[model samples]
Target: MLARDESDLKRTPLHALHLARGGKMVPFAGYEMPVQYPAGVLKEHLHTRSHAGLFDVSHMGQIALRPKSGKVSDAALALERLVPQDILGVAPGRQRYAQFTNADGGILDDLMVANFGDHLFLVVNAACKAEDEAHLRKHLSDACDIDSLADRALIALQGPKAESALAKICADAPSMKFMDAGPRRVAGFDCFVSRSGYTGEDGFEISVPAEHAEALVTQLLDNPDVLPIGLGARDSLRLEAGLCLYGHDIDTTTTPVEAALEWSVQKSRRKGGARTGGFPGAEKILDQFERGAPRRRVGLKAQGRAPVREGAALFADADTGEAIGKVTSGGFGPSLNAPVAMGYLPTALSGIGTTVFAEVRGQRLPLAVAATPFVPNTYKR
Candidate 1:
């Protein structure tokens, strides 16, 4: 692990605790997050799949967006106007994944929005928090309050054993369904717990007060089944699960439909027609929906042991050398034990089993458009 000066990188609330546990900190999203522990990224990736792995994701922005007029429905409608998800139908204690879109229907960022009784809670990417918060405040009416919860720390306990591990600390842990959230008392501290994660595993993301983060994390890690994980493994895990990283797979230039995330657009939006199509790039998105995007995101598999990284140019024909697309996210999938990648190619060449070529260091490598989730996702529902 490469160790840089702790002063240069921002630290989460549990930064000291991570160092104490032999965590190797690295710069990620401007924070000194652990990319791996003493066990290494490979082991951490495997541990999170087979057992429970605790991850400190405190850098992620947590914000509360209360309706301007103190009316929850108004806030939901306002948010639904911007995102593709059905936020208006979100029942109390339930959360929905949504995308922040630009005028062109390109994704600005992906976030989780939860309806917490009277208020709405949002979990946004750490890297895009500033832009996201500013956008939310500027667009929302004064009746709504957009407040950041910087005093809180976020932690994810991911894997099939997440419930058992968390149950050791909180009694009602097992009853929570996927995407369900609630406030709970753990070790005499009030914390908000959600049954959700990014690794495509059954898990929970716990939001604890910064002052209490250390003790709460300690209690969870004390369980024999729980190990500490880091960002490197988190990337590999999401890759195997076919989930997109904000700046990688999905970006400002990639529309949700082109990225094959049309499911994120709720049925109401599709049915409302012109009335609901008031969001940024709505015309283009609706047109794409009516017609179709010229290019589509697809998964790729290298035909050799060498792992392909992002920026590899994709070719239209193996022998023609015609450039068609480029690799977005690529890595050695720990779960699949092979090299897997994702990229966007011309619609005609995006079919499954289509042979493609990738230019790696001037060497033409054979590739193929394969079905994603290279490894079957084990998400709990």
Candidate 2:
């Protein structure tokens, strides 16, 4: 849900930095977040593609998982009980994307988990933090200690010059590959830098203590290559990257398989494998693998100028009357120079070249089911 009123909205550690830079603030996920700056969304989106861009994502939930028995694998295994992921298999310093699923095979939230040698670190959506913390404590308390990292702030440096820009401040940052994470001393501040980002670019997500956030952000922004970006550009960049926004692309009523994220669930968690049927909705999820879901998420390219926004109903172009599916996330791809979107359609009409219609403002606009990544992903491996 979007934040609406600033009077009661919470503020992040970087809230002042955004305001100082003339950010147009908006309520988002219970916080006064920056949706855009004076440069505007279009320029901000393009700047991040050409140069490095810094984003303040401190509103997200950061969690630390510690095992009482002092065993890393034990903590990892405990996490596997709630989500349909092979958390125990995550190697030290590596991370994986996972989702907390419901008994009906629906997703509660999606997150990233990193193995930090002695403990596990998780980054979850801002709106789902409380629920996620409760879920972890309810099921994993016996094996591990769960706590929120409320004293930290996170920033992302993204785009083509991300590595070089980061390397200038932190010598070890450039060495990390995709999904790799560990501690590093950057500008004399102890921080956790993960070579991962949301823009489908080669970049890093840095986690630093709250006290050091401002200094770190100031240092990165001084690099000339890095400009401060806001939420509007963040959404557009992620959309072009074809990444899923939790509430829009996935939710409690959507399963991982239905959302086309089966790859994130390793083979070990599937039926006939070790620890099968152990997680929430294991049976339903595995069954969907053999017998696919009736409706599936797919990428859509609008044939007209109007954007097919979320909740817009999809219909068969030829049938004209019966609705087949609905758009979950839709917008104009600044990089693609055209309108791009993602939606769910029945398998019969979900083929890559299938034609469909979006009922936007009473006009049934034509849309085509196309492969995702409306813009090519350039993540460094």
- TM-scores for every candidate against the unseen true structure: 0.95, 0.98
lDDT of 1 by residue, 1-381 (tens): 222665667789999989998988778877998888899989999999999899999999999989867778778888876787778888989888889889988999999999887889999999899889999988875557899999999999999899998888898888888999868876678888889998988999999999999999999888989999989999999888888999989999999989988877877676464345767777788788879899999999999977888999899766675789999999898878889999999988899999888888888788889987787766555
Clashing pairs in 2: none
Q: What is the C-alpha lDDT profile of model 2 across 1-381, one tens digit per residue?
A: 665556889899998899999999999999999999899899889999999889999999999999989999999888898889999999999999999999999999999999999999999999999999999999999999998999999999999999998898899987789999877888889999898989988899999999999999998889888889999999989988888999999999999988999889898888877877688888899999889998899999998888889999999964457888999999888888899899999987889988899998887889999998888888878
On a 0 to 1 TM-score scale, where does candidate 2 land against the true structure?
A: 0.98
**In model 2, what lDDT does residue 346 have?**
91
Give stretches of model 1 more than 4 Å off. Answer: 1-8, 271-275
Residue 199 of model 2, lDDT score = 92
